[model samples]
Target chain A: MDYFFFIDLIQSTVDGLLFGTTYALIGIGFTLIFGVMRKLNLAYGAAALAGTYIGLVVFLMFDAHPALVFLASALGSGLIGLVVYLCCFRFTPSNYPMASLLASVGMLLFIDEVVIHASHGLPYPYPSVFRDAIIELGDVWVRGDLLFVFFMCVVAMAALFWLLYRTPLGLATRAVSQQPRAAQLCGIDVTRVNMMTFGIAGVLGGIAGAMTAAAVGVLSPVIAMGLTVKGLIVVVIGGLGSIPGAIIGGLLVGAAENIFLLLRGVTERDIYVMLLLFIFLTLRPGGLFGSAQTRD
Target chain B: MLEIADIKTSYGKIAALKGVSLDIHDGGLTCLLGPNGAGKTTLIWTIAGILKAQAGSMKIDSEEILGLKPHQIVSKGIVTVPENRLVFPDMSVRDNLIAGAFSRRKEKGGIEGDLEDVLTRFPRLRERSEQMAGTLSGGEQQMLAVGRALMARPKILLMDEPSTGLAPIIVEEIFEIIGGLRDEGRTIFLVEQNAHMALKYADRFYLLEQGRVTFSGEPGAVDHDEVIQRAYLGARKAS
Candidate 1:
């Protein structure tokens, strides 16, 4: 009822919206891979974390520019993504979908442990141009790093959309996603297309990882677990394989989390978010934009 | 010419195609007529490299191709129009046709020219080129599937039950298209349950039952009713 509370709510929503860009990027990656593979890569967050760590390594060793660090992260994550595809998805027979699913979960833990061991369980400062800067817009203040992340996410998503809708490679990827057999008959190598999908998703994950780390100004293994949870929540809330659904879901979850944090404090915040997920699952399992097809 | 010899394929332990051998002559419309579960679709899939044969040889002009992947087989200029018209449902008709040219992506001019050719061949597709493939009528989807396969510039086209689930009038139209393709000197292997229609355009016919070829010869060598009866009912026991 207080005027200050209304202003706080608006500011929190703005903050959440900007922060949600990281989740949106991660969600887009998940949806892209799921769209092609029809299987969840549970290692996605850990893979992104590994990429961020690589970026931090480059920063420490070469004292690279922030742009170089981001590029390194994307490349490192893309390589790891190919490896994950070979181990977790490629050799496994598709008829046994659970095999790939469990393999990815195993990969998640394996990569997390590797990062923890390498970093000695310590948090590193991630380089960013606007780590401590802020901008004032009317009565609300927006973090400069969050704004930067939002800008980069928008650019990346635009590029991704162009790749999917306009390029020949995009056509093949979409064809494989829609009907793999038909695509194969059209002379598409299904395995090659799938590997490319994972690589692209990995690249997106890397950027999301760097953006999140830069926004927080810290890189730690602990971030990976939370990110994995948040990414899955975003995917489910948005739609399993829908790109637009992922972006909208990410923003919704972000805004919801901030409001819940304001209303119920940090401890109780996630409970309400989980409750929202539950409501979606029960009432609209297809998600915001998912088709009515059953996942299994 | 495509030669398949002693090809065996299985679904887990159950065999779908067992030691099947057949030859598709150059510039001929060869139709495989069979009843439900007669392994007609299985043979089409096997030839397309969608299903791997456990043993045997498939040769395109004496070059063994049995172990090759689907895309590799497609590069050899064999394209398939799968049953149920498996066009990319969410994509526009133009995109679907473009996707068919995926193997030949490096040939920009050929693709553009082929796009024009396919659109001209199927004008209904041109009218709805921007429409989502899933929204097209069943006959249109079949036409799209055929056109999509054609976009690959296939030397040999394999069509599986293109008439399945289409209206009666639509089936005749599709056969007319098949006849047109035959007249153009394109080699075709069609798997169909519509024996009467297939027989009309088929230069050669193979009747398959339970994964083996029960009968095969030029269409003029057999009675139309006899081939239709043999397709539905199993070969009348040696009597």
Candidate 2:
């Protein structure tokens, strides 16, 4: 019994870590937009869901390849991101952060309603690239789809790092993030940079959405709100604007969630996750890697 | 040459610059001396397109440039070294300098050459190139701010209180740099509370009081002590 319990713990941890990559990808999308604009985009998950829904339509109608679906999802979501910036963030008075937050929440509900109406509030089958493929490591089993998600997440992060460090647009984005007024004096166009940031976040979200749907082998409107809540929890636990923090936060949340599921049950899992968030908030409000003083 | 005629700027209901007029001539340093709240920074921001002027005409060599954006103004070769040395603290000194050339990002070769030249001009910054700007001392930060503006290749440099909050020796070093820029035939519009250092380098000087230009003349034409006193105190007391 003791040996079996240890094996179960290890297996759960491995599974959680792999699944956490999806959460990290989603968390990164949130962090990137927040880093640049210093505003929460509550509609981020819904936007991703919208892209996933589009990908589902393409797959259903044309019998598209998995790669084509992911591509379509990214492009569709990227366009929606720009639209969200224009509608929810762009024209709002910059000083009024609450207005933008509320606007994004409104967008979130609108997108959820749209998706529900389009699909008749029903879940759709999402094709998995690595369907039924699992690797056996002694007593533990690893899903090939989850491993693929992990690999894709690493590739995405590496690409993100390269874009942020080696490109002019990335430099401008960092500059604007650090000191917006100074960036303006440096002749960096703040509005253009902000719009581009939103688009990038959207692309990331779409990929994450597609990956999550494939992992679950289903896509539904309910996933939109669930992902948003999970994404926010990851952001808060990691640190508001720290990229690395979001990744770690996602993994930590994932592992803790699985452990709680084993100790308690499915119904009581989120209770422990919320408890963990509260502990982090009370003891280390800046999160695992954030400075105490954040941009107000 | 830059011309400012009847430029009026306000902060909400409070007007900071009321019908302010001045001429910033080519290839010479024109200094504006004023007490606190005399609209010196306001004028600089307005000229740099960071602030809007309710009523005025700002012309650069006969082209109207009053309503242009800040980056547009920068591309026009008007760069500003803002007050309080606002550097991007989280970025390295080198990155800060590179960001200064954002307006001319397409000119790769020119940017590289300019970056080398700026580093050479401030060796201290070169030594701390990889260090974050926030970690630098106040004096070093001031140097970084000036170097940042220089990277923009400005035809007209608008400097606002470059000497504020620095050691006396550092202030002298900063003035020397400013004086060096003036000698290099750069058109400079300087707003300063340090009238003494400003007078040492200014070809012409203006005294601004309560949002208006109250006095304008060559530095040599005025008594240095009286002008310094008037700069610290309002013109009403000096009169």
Candidate 3:
């Protein structure tokens, strides 16, 4: 019995290691938005889930493959991200950064309500390619779909890294992020760069949302807030606006939650995750990769 | 040539420039000397279109540009090297120079040629091309700022206090570069507190105090004592 429990723990750990990539993707979207605009986009999690639903509708209408559905979802979410910026961020008085934050929170609720109404508060079986296929490594088994998700995560991260560090567009983004006024003086349109950042982050969120729904094999409107809390935790623990920090933080949170769930139960599992966030906030508020908390 | 008429700029309730007016020639060095809070910086920002003038007209070559955006000003051959060397600190020196030529991004060959010209003029920047702008010393950053502005290939350069907070040797070096720019047939509108150094190079001088122009004259005929007195200390004492 004890040996069986140990195996269960190891399996759950492996499962979390794969699932952590989804969390990292979600957190990266949040971090990129924060990095460029210096504002928290609270609606990102809800937007991601909404994107997944849009993908489902596209699949139903066209009988498209899962890959195409995923693509559609990402593109749709990118559009939504731009819309959110236009409605919530663009026209808000520049003097009040808090206004954008509060507005985004309102957007989060607005998106959530829309999703709830459209779905009638129901949970549906989501598409999961290669769901039953498994890999056996001695005494352990790995889900094939999870392995695919991990592979996708690596590809997306690499593409993002190239886009951010290697291209002139990335340079423009960095310039806008650091000194918007100086960038404007340099003849770079600051507003355009901001819009680009939001679009990129939105696509990333859509990917994360679709992948998460596939991994869980079900989609529920209720998980929007939970995913949001998880993403916020990842961003805080990873250090705000730090890409590598988000990745590491997501993995850490996923592993800790899995371990906690194994040791305790479902009711107490979230307590440990919250405790970890509190500990990081108290001990190292700058996060593992952040230098300091300077609100832009 | 740049011309301003009745330019009134304010911050909230307090007016920084109260109907201030000035003219800059096409190929001469013009210096604006003023005490702190006398709105010299405000004047520079207003001309650069960073601050909007409430009731005024600014013309560059007969084109009205009072309400135009900053980038538009740059496009129309007016560029400003701001105070405190406001270069992108994290960007490489080369990048800082490249950004200066951003308005001319469409003119690839011209930008490349101007870059080479700027590099030849400021060899120190060439040496530190890959270094971050923030990592450079105060004097180097100031030089980078000037070089960056030249990348725009401006017809008239508006420089605000290029010599602030620098050693005497560095100040001399900066002034020499400013003199070089003037000799290159570029119009320069310089704002400075160091009247002694400026009078040697400036063709025309304007002294501002309390958001108004107190004095404007040629270098040789101006009363130096009165100018210095107003510069270091505020208010001309009920005269």
Q: TM-score of A-chain in each prediction?
A: 0.97, 0.97, 0.95
- Give interface RMSD for all predictions: 1.9, 1.6, 2.0
Worst 10 residues of 3 chain A by lDDT: A287-296
The collision pairs in model 1 are: none
RMSD of each: 1.4, 1.5, 2.5
lDDT of candidate 3 over B108-161, digit per residue (tens): 488778888888999999999999998999999999999989998888898999
- Predicted structure 1: clash tally: 0
DockQ of each: 0.77, 0.73, 0.51
lDDT of 2 at A158: 87
Instruction: State the TM-score of candidate 2 restricted to chain B.
Output: 0.97
Model 1: residue A122 alpha-carbon error in angstroms: 1.8
TM-score of chain B of each: 0.98, 0.97, 0.97
Candidate 1 TM-score over all chains jointly? 0.98
lDDT, residue A54, model 3 = 89
What is model 3's DockQ versus the real complex? 0.51
